[model samples]
Target: ADHRVSLPLAALLGAAFLPLADVAARVIDRPAETPVGILVAAAGSPFFILLARRIGRR
Candidate 1:
């Protein structure tokens, strides 16, 4: 889509998400903060690494 069409929709959706992201950021803001998404991503990384190692062993 053209920028004219997309920009308006993006602004509408972004406004809805902005408040939620702000709330999440506030919740996640801690001294030793580990974001939920990041922790999940890190947990996934080990699985991928193990898969790669198993493939290499073949």
Candidate 2:
């Protein structure tokens, strides 16, 4: 629960997530590539909404 630990863990997870998303983008479209932002946003939006809602509740 410490910021020190959570920050680094978040960074590591983000680093890991981007590459996986990028790979998915490349593979998903075959001859073309999906924009990484689109993939990232699509994946992140729901989480962001949930986080916002949780914070709002607090």
Error of 2 at 33 (Å): 0.6
* Per-residue alpha-carbon lDDT of candidate 2 for residues 1-58, written as tens digits (9 for 90 to 100): 6999999999999999999999999999999999999999999999999999999998
Query: TM-score for model 1?
Result: 0.41
Per-residue accuracy of model 1 over 13-45 as CA lDDT, tens digit each: 867765665556557766554455664455458
Per-prediction TM-score, please?
A: 0.41, 0.93
**Predicted structure 2, TM vs. truth:** 0.93
Each prediction's total of clashing residue pairs, residues at least 3 apart in sequence or on different chains, is 0, 0
Candidate that would win on lDDT? 2
